[model samples]
Target: MLEQSTRSERGSMTGEEARRAVREGRLSCQTSSLAPGYVQGNLVVLPQDIAGDFLRFCQRNPKPCPIIGMTEPGDPHIPDLGVDLDLRTDLPGYRVWRDGELVEEPGDLLSHWRDDLVGFVIGCSFSFEEALLADGLEVRNVAEGVNVSMFRTSIPCAPAGPFAGPVVVTMRPFSPADAIRAIQITSRFPSVHGAPIHIGQPEQIGIRDLSKPDYGDPVAIRDGELPVFWACGVTPQAVIAAARPPFAITHAPGAMLVTDLKNSRLSIL
Candidate 1:
């Protein structure tokens, strides 16, 4: 569990400062509340042999796999994202997958790096959560100091090559009025998942219970609050698992890559 004190301290960090802390092993917690105004991303590393196919998968399903930054095979630096970014040691945590099975969750990928590896950074809801919070909408997970609840849905993502799976979603609860405001606020940031995909019905998306989520922590829904679901970056990990790629690496849920890009820059409006 992340200490609320830690969250509060890191919450005010600049994107570069946060990444440096992660790189230096000073911090290894979820990026959810860290680097407040910057874009935090989902990391996906794959061998060049499968990178093209995965790229197509992201293209086919933009809502869940919006590409914010990508690196050439074997190259660790995406200069556009940060002047001194080092993919091998940047993210708070990473899950290694082999044959679609998660084998290990490592803090860094130094031993796992290879000449054939390619890196991708997908936009995460953390970006738009900043927008919603700025608009005074309560974000339960953030307020409760836990990961946003995420679930696998009956809805399917458009398949591309070997990547195909259920569309994964992150959930937040709000009153009807705030839900509408959240919709309007989030719509401005399409790259980070623009709007709620499903509202008021968990069973419709194959989610049996709001108390039990497939990923992240579950938060309480007060009376009169409705659960809202949005496409999540975890969809790529789900696809990677289903496809059983020979090898893959992705950020652990909520433990994202804090990039230098500001969240406001990703807003469409």
Candidate 2:
């Protein structure tokens, strides 16, 4: 009975249930472990001056940076996200960058709000993770209670003026059978980084060590479990940090924006 209680406490909520919790301030933390079968997004807010170029960057590189929904310049609402969604405060956490350097990490984007900033929602690994879980495969980060580790690879992005940098990927270690299931499950969600780019060879992508990642926390790779890579939405944040635009905003790593759209809606077929 005690073990049952513990398991129930650790159990996650459904997508719509969690979204309502977030709106009510009951669940104001990482959305990763919140909604088991919903879509969560990585966010990027930039000046109208650079948004056009950035759009092209996403266009050129859809795998690592799929655009889920975008807002008009200076607008705070993305109707597709939610009816009451306010870009300034709906999220749990935000990262503010000034002149290309990270300057502040806030609970909301209200103070940093500007008339020229535009919001872009990128399809996140949460979609793919849901697919994996549905196939009865374990996601190590979800199992271990940590952010999925992200790495910057030697691979270059198709340069778009000042927005060019190496592609970044998130790693998850799975057994061979689970890994194959992950590949097939994720392949259906093309908008959210479909399938594995490189599996089992971390060093080939300039990732020197599994324990040391550029961002997020590392998880164990059990015996016979191989590490798999997927094009990550975090790639844009890395690029923005390197490009150093005068001002930028991003969803804090792992604290993604939960949209009204369902994960199933993102599946290409």
Clashes of each: 1, 1
Cα lDDT of model 1 by residue, 1-269, tens digit: 54333766697889898888888877877776687898888899999999999999999998999999999999988999998898899898889998888899988999999999999999988889888888888899989988889999999999988889999999999999999899898889888888888999889989998999999899999999999999999899888888898899988866889889999998888
Best by TM-score: 1
Give the clashing residue pairs of candidate 1, or none.
100-244
Off by over 4 Å in 1: 1-9
Q: What is the C-alpha lDDT profile of model 2 across 218-262, one tens digit per residue?
A: 899899999999998878888888889999999876678777787
| Residue 262, candidate 1: alpha-carbon lDDT | 95
TM-score of each: 0.92, 0.89
Index of the highest-lDDT prediction: 1
Over the full model, what C-alpha lDDT does candidate 2 score relative to the true structure? Answer: 0.83
Sequence-dependent TM-score of model 1: 0.92
